[model samples]
Target chain A: MKKLKRSARLVEMTQFLLARPHQLIPLTTFAQRYGAAKSSISEDLAIIKEVFEDEGTGELQTLAGAAGGVKYIPKMGREQALHFIEQLCEKLAEPNRILPGGYLYMSDLLGLPGLMNEAGKLFATAFAGRDIDCVMTVETKGIPLAYATGAELNLPVVLVRRDHQVTEGSAVSINYVSGSHKSLHTMSLSRRALKEKSKVLIVDDFMKAGGTIQGMVDLLAEFNAVVAGVGVLVESGEVETEQRLLRDYVSLATLRAVDAKGKEISVEPGNYFSRK
Target chain B: MKKLKRSARLVEMTQFLLARPHQLIPLTTFAQRYGAAKSSISEDLAIIKEVFEDEGTGELQTLAGAAGGVKYIPKMGREQALHFIEQLCEKLAEPNRILPGGYLYMSDLLGLPGLMNEAGKLFATAFAGRDIDCVMTVETKGIPLAYATGAELNLPVVLVRRDHQVTEGSAVSINYVSGSHKSLHTMSLSRRALKEKSKVLIVDDFMKAGGTIQGMVDLLAEFNAVVAGVGVLVESGEVETEQRLLRDYVSLATLRAVDAKGKEISVEPGNYFSRK
Candidate 1:
């Protein structure tokens, strides 16, 4: 790469850092890439760090040492996250979202990339500084949220399949009760998909009794992996406290009520805010 | 927001543009956000544009007139994309990726956010300037790829479910023959999931006889939608020409052979390069 002006270097540096989150990059690499001095690179980073902080995008952590460089920690400020979730609740509360059998139609909301990206940032903010190795979610709806969170955290995502596929050879399968009906269901994960003793973060789109999440946890036990954390986009408030299979988890929104016949629905910010 | 220094503004402007790809943002928005003059915002965008172009990250397209604004079109250069696809081919060629039925284990690679992000950029580049309304893919493996492509394209993703879930109110289901065994399988899409006559871009993880992709195309016909394009991560070379269901599609890599017993595999750059 040829030498670039300070303005060009600054723009390039910002783009580079934004693309890579949670990974440390040495100043020398930037200096060399821009054909600038280490001092210039550090000065450029300082400017980026301030803007990132002021704008509530995230933090630019600099480590001081021979082997240290800088790391970008993607996050959404508490106030901004709250505002976003409030808007999400408003959207989720739309009467049209109520489907048959008291189910809510959230696939449309989940389809938005911008919305998913924001939700991912919130989850990353909530789970920041945790020793998590990877993000795990069961198909077929939770995959997008899991990938979004994985992107923000700079971690790989592992998907738990609802049915075993020949493509995922030699899988460990587990059965658990799910939904309001307490119907038995089977979920599996490929043996090669996860490493033993991995600190995994479980993510999902929705949780009722948390039986599905419990199934994932139980499946993880077969692989000797530890559950680092659990995050869900929505949780059923209708579930009785005693009926809930999981105790500790994070949710962005809580589905309060759904009146299918009357076309009424209610949604509120999840326990994420109160948990803090 | 308060006024910011030139350096801080530059970093913020870069981050802003990077996040909202393919969406036009008026200069006035930046001006108001930074409490800066339109001239200053223009200058900042110019610098960011130059760096983005020079780095081959993407292009910052500026429109003229009252409604005009700047839009970020994320792209990967042909040479850079080829280099990436070559690396992907090498990774796919690993003998250990071979499964019992000669299926390659690509879940780990697909799970990588960085890789998916890059692949998304490549697909976005390939399909740049197309009249794409939404990105569509089947569950459960292709969701991430579709979301990745959707994020890059700044569009929504519609998932075609393998089985109809009650949560998806009313849906249109289609039956198609898939795999070497030619077994019939069902796929469904929620009626509310897609708008009528939408121009959709289909994406997937792999294609053998193109049966699954064809199934998605056939299902799209139910909604009177137009197939704008199809993109796949890998295609099988073993599928005979006459037996292949689809012809027009883009792929990153091609699986030439997989010897599960001998632990041998062969992979190469797909028709994406040849099509170009």
Candidate 2:
């Protein structure tokens, strides 16, 4: 058989994969398209696969069996995810993030995808083998990251609002104390937003005093849903109250804030990227 | 020259691209490395390039000069970025996102990467080809997206805080109102955090009004820096002030809250992937 030229073979391989997402394509088809040996197609697959994997930006899966073929799954690995969050935390620890009245100026973190992607990936992996129907997060800040995680898992994400809007219809409201020790603040979720018995992964941009998270836990109970896990992008280590409520928690960085001189310390977890 | 078997050629090509970050590799190198004719290596490069590009997760740069080579730059296209954000905005618009008070629930957006990666790419593209010395964002929510944008641009990110911290060493502070009009807020930046004459890109998770964004703009002016761009993952048409402040603005989704039925609408921008 005449061997197909390499350029033609490459184009055929790309076309085959692009046609199907999350589905495997056999080597034989590529070889047949190029009139080259199966071995030639395998070589083409190897090159394509390596570039995606090395970038830690996408996935190329090689299925080895009678149905063996390669599939590209856009995925971020555990290590890559952690490394990304750690870097964000380090930047967060800088003095610039501290706002008056001890608040962190977090508008940027709320919008950033690199940090959000890593944080989402870390939490997603924790619940990977579990049955999670949806991702739950609070508003203003958590929206971007939750949206990211939901897309990665291909699951629908539901938001829990703090106020009752005329549009939300009926909502189950929970009264909680504000972080500033003000009057009881109300956190609510739409009655129809969560499905009964659905497993949920709760995520928040920042955790302090456990009031908002606890409110979410209460809201999940309102629907008879299961709280699968809890994740936070930034957890204030200085605040001692929140640690007691966390179960299966992943924090991108810990905030060590010094009160007197206004100094802050940051640390990243080692598990963000795989060592091997 | 004799061409190597297809399998061996692929493995070699994959390994080579993985080691080089942001640098382009030419087809000729593969021919020389595998002792294959230029035509053969060209075939391999074409195949590999197509797969990565089709995924909308990474970039492939083809150079024609003798000094030029095939460079695989890890990036996401504009359309993919817009699609991901549009999906998130749709989720956010649900009546479910409304809480009891006038606040949004955004935990899901912060935890999702597939979405965040897209948002990050869009922000990176907004500032592409510009002189951006550093990326600045406030802490907590904005940190992750800022890091993602910085990583893509290969630049260092600076975090701004709300208050003065001794650890960050004498920060400059500015007070601004919250977009929600809930309270007065302060934004801070370490006196030494940003260098003078630097070009900065401002990014965050959500922009309700231009309040926080304006504060950051003022802070940059204090540092004698230029605002290269302003990017947000979500822009609330509910609040319409941010559009006039940025020369370049990109968002995955726009929130148009209409009527009291709690009905909201969203759409992704086609330009997110068009530039690539």
Off by over 4 Å in 1: none
TM-score for each candidate, following the candidate numbering: 0.98, 0.57
* lDDT, residue A177, candidate 1: 84
DockQ of candidates 1 onward, in order?
Answer: 0.88, 0.12
State in Å the error of residue A70, model 1.
0.2
Worst 10 residues of 1 chain B by lDDT: B95-104
Q: After superposition, how far is residue B120 of candidate 1 from its true place, in Å?
A: 1.1
- Mind giving the per-residue lDDT tens digits that candidate 1 earns over B1-276? 888888888888889889999999998999899899999888888888888888899999999999989999999987899899999999999888887767788889989988988988889999998999999999878888899999999999998998899989899999999955699999999999999999999999999999999999999999999899999999999999889999999999999988878898989899988888
Predicted structure 2: lDDT = 0.64
Model 1 agreement with the true structure over A1-276: per-residue lDDT tens digits = 979888888888899999999999998889778888899999999999999998889999999888989999999988898899999999999998877778889999999988998999999999988999999999888888998999999999998988999988889999988856789999989999999999999999999999899989999999999999999999999999998989899999999988888888888899999887
Q: What TM-score describes the B chain of model 1? A: 0.97
State fnat for each of the candidate structures. Answer: 0.88, 0.09
Give residue A39's error in model 2 in angstroms: 12
Q: Model 1's lDDT to the true fold?
A: 0.91
Q: Which stretches of candidate 2 lie over 4 Å from their true place?
A: A1-123, A137-152, A156-196, A203-215, A231-243, A246-276, B1-59, B62-116, B136-171, B176-197, B204-212, B232-276
